[model samples]
Target: MSVNRRSILRTTAQLATLTAAGGLLTGCGQEAATGGGAAASEHPAHPSPTPGAPTVLTPNRIPAATPSAAVSGAPSAESAGASPSAPEQPPLAANTPAEVISGPSDRPQVALTFHGQGDPRLATALLTAAEQHGAKVTVLVVGSWLDQQPQMARRILDGGHELGNHTLNHLDISSLSADQAYAEIAGCADRIKALTGSIGRWFRPSAAQFATARVKAQARKAGYEHCLSYGLDPRDYADPGAEVIQRRMLGSIKPGSIVALHMGHQGTVDALPAVLEALQQRGLSAVTASQLCS
Candidate 1:
């Protein structure tokens, strides 16, 4: 299905039900597969980065805070309440810059980013293809999707890629009030932190595809320095044939471009090999968004 704003909003309720149901199914499958017991340690906590070692900064080139520190800065769910126009407070003083449209133009690299809330198999396929081609891409995951398949976060991180937030339920932040907006951003950040020991490196507003000033501020408050937007969108969510997707992406790509693709679509999975090959032919390497920006 095409995932334009109107369609996303229209299907929001249905998607919520699907996500919840999927989570239950996933939990059951895990129990059965693991002999009906939770592993003693599923995801081990990531150790603190060694001092003087290079850290992965947000696209704005700002250092990210520890997950605990970031969560502390965000408004608590209880504080968010039910009001729409809750007074906006400035995020913590340590908040990073707001948005990053594209990375530095001087490099012969581009970032391929996927917005995922679909089949985990397709995500694995996409990641496998990138790895085969000596590439790494960014994945901005939906919180509910992660709730369904928490292991996907570890898969992304373990593959030496990056992950970020795409909100809890793919809501259009533009239509939401400040308090509600903070919940969406922070809610997803909380999920990422639980799995990966920190919120993923970037935040991208869902459904609307671009962040409003208020939304950006909320995201910053949630500890994301970069609100990632794309320079190239292949519209893979539309399920255009693989050939069309490959053509549009290759045609639109430039040095430092951030290309937006989607998960759940077989076409995107099919298109990736050619797309990566085309990038090589153009002497442009595909990298994680932070790597492209850095």
Candidate 2:
């Protein structure tokens, strides 16, 4: 994925245009997620699901506002993530996109992502694989899953992994009505916020690789500047053997690629070591989605 001149200019302009007053995130636009309107984009708009992915600038971080209370007994660190000490991204301008699929190809990094809701042991095992290989990952979790496994939230952020919303029920978000879809997104956000201080960072629509325009709009209303999409889907969820998953990922991965995997499967956990080794062989670092996209 070569850098697009237009995207670079757009990024520069967006950075320059951010009002000193707008703060980290702007309010939701007039367009409703379920109601019809043009889809919002940050950069490299209307990207295809194919390999030629977009090269994006650093996306803004989630609003640094008070976390909405949803659960109690959360530790201070979980209430306020450890990563906030890092430099903050500039505020988003009006009409930022509701989805992001890839990052700047100029960097030799790839993001390994998981859809949360699996065996806790398996989840920790996957994280161990990444940590052992000196990698970081992103987890987009279902809101209700967090409700069941609140400790996992602290474990994820503590392990230097990114956490985001994957909707409440992990349902077919695109097909739901506007109100239902926003609930799916905001519901998870509240859950994440209850356990983790920030409202997480990114939102990914469930049961879909790419968000529909309506889903994007709904995500925006839910306070997500971008709904995360992936550039690579090795289909680890298919329960193929570890070797098959490894082969598919190594065969198709590229710089700035966001590779989607799942938990609850031993094969995916088994495949991580080889995949991380293969990534090293290809001179690609396994980074969090925030690092890759930023």
Candidate 3:
């Protein structure tokens, strides 16, 4: 359940092999900045500029000065001129503005977000439990995880949960080149569409580590509404005791807040019953991430 720092590094090397073979690596995150298992080497320390590469900032949004030559590689024509072969896309399909759908008055209505590597039974158990409460949770389905457990993903959809893109590999977007970042997100989106005929709306930066403005801009360019965390760090990756998980979640209850949990932990499953019971007591209902946005 808990991968050590050394184990994480070893796993990352294995992941690189999969990537080289054109396989997707999803759901492999390590806590670095916020105990979310964000590996320092996983993402590049500085941003690279590649013309035609997707970037969070642009001349329209930021200053007109061109990105440095070193950061920006050879400019692709698309960066300067439009191509006739390019397909037109809807605004929302590519980039939607971020929103917090708070209602007129305060009530316990919020979305729960989970982060972790893949486990088939864990996904199924979470879906079944959520369905029992008639609640919807948003799952940031990673490409690697999906490739390994497509059946489980179908179950998430069947149970009425929303699927969001968690990236091809769980690399920190802040550390990847603009084009690499685009490929990570776009590749995942492509896989999801091929499998489910649905496009993702929400994107949670790996480990919720949004260190660079460019990464955020790149997300917008890639057509994802950025998902920022609000409260209830259940720290499921750490394998907290069920009692401790329940207490932290109960203490952090708030309307319109997004609770962070992991899909790989049995402790999370063990704590869910109590969490659900408490939510019912407080007159709250968990909705999918998209529903919360709506």
User: Which number leads on TM-score?
Assistant: 2
Error of 2 at 235 (Å): 0.9
1-294: candidate 1 lDDT, tens digit per residue: 556977888799789999999988765443110001111100122121112222221122222232343332233323333122222122322322457778778889999998865677888898999999999888988665665566777778778788898875455567667766666677667767666666766898876657899988888787887788887887777677999999899888899898888776789999999999988999999988777765
lDDT of 2 by residue, 156-209 (tens): 887888888887655566667776676567756766665655676688887788
> Sort by TM-score, best first: what order?
2, 1, 3
lDDT of 3 by residue, 217-293 (tens): 66667676564444556666666679999998888767777777777667888888889878888888888665665
Better of 1 and 3 by TM-score: 1
Q: How well does each candidate superpose onto the true structure, as a TM-score? A: 0.68, 0.70, 0.64
Any idea what lDDT model 3 has?
A: 0.56
- What's the C-alpha lDDT at position 196 in model 3? 59
| Better candidate number, 2 or 3, judged by TM-score | 2
